[model samples]
Target: MKTTITVNGEARALDLDTRVTLLDALREHLGLKGSKKGCDHGQCGACTVLVNGVRINACLSLAVMHDGDEVTTIEGIGTEAALHPLQQAFLTQDAFQCGYCTPGQICSAVGMLQEAAQNWPSQATEDLTAAIALTDAEIRERMSGNICRCSAYPQILAAIRDVAGEPA
Candidate 1:
């Protein structure tokens, strides 16, 4: 199957098997290695990427399923010299220890921030109708999917809180 997915602000056309997962398509064909494949299963958020502005596990979805969709990998989030706010926060806050899960953590944080800005509710939310607060509990719950084996969770939560304009 041939499909075009807008990744990191560029349209990439590839002829691949429909069974190919988006994670494979990005890393193998597109050479976008920011999204890691920590676990082939969707249990880990290591393959998280933004599909049409929403975060999804690339490993869980087929490339063909997202034809013409806008996909944002960690590479698309910022340049090497100029990091995205979340990226910068992660750096200054030392949010990552091993750094393997940083890409997914950052990508998921980006989506989570967007969701919070839009007043979206998460499992940690107390009141659905009230303005969503960027609390540490909320951040933790929202970022629960991305596992940091190094256990730099406090720093990760701090980075997210900093980017979300909350106190550390």
Candidate 2:
């Protein structure tokens, strides 16, 4: 099967097997290595990416399923000269210690803010009908999927809250 994906604002196509996972397609074929392969079982958020402005685990879906979809990876979030606010917040907050999970965290954080803005219901939210608020509890719930083994979670949460305009 042939699929065209808009990755990082670039149109790219590949002849992939229907069984090929999006993570494999991104790393193996497209050479977008920002999304990690952590568990490769959808259990880990390491392979998370934005699909049409939503965060998803690339390993959970097939490449053919994303035909003509707008995909955004961590690399697409910003450039070396101009970093995304979440990237800058992560850097300033020292969100990662080993750095392997940084890509996933950054990607997840980017989409998370968008999700929050959309009034996505979270367990921490006292009122779901109101505009989503970025409380420390809510940030933790939204970022629950991404794990940082280096114990940099405090900084990670701080960075995300900062970008979301929620104080530490």
Best by TM-score: 1
RMSD of candidate 2 to the true fold?
A: 1.0
Query: Where does model 1 exceed 4 Å of error?
Result: none
Q: Worst lDDT window (10 residues) for model 2?
A: 159-168
- For model 1, residues 1-168, the per-residue Cα lDDT tens digits are 989999988999999998999999999999989899998898879999999999999999999999999999999998999899999999999988889999999999999999899999999999999999888999999999999999999999988888889754
Against the true structure, what is each candidate's TM-score?
0.97, 0.96
Candidate 2 lDDT, 1-168, residue by residue in tens: 989998988999889989999999999998889899999887768898999999999999999999999999998989999999999999999888889889998999889898888888888889867877788999999899887778798999988888788665
True-vs-predicted CA distance for residue 51, candidate 1, Å: 0.6
TM-score of 1: 0.97
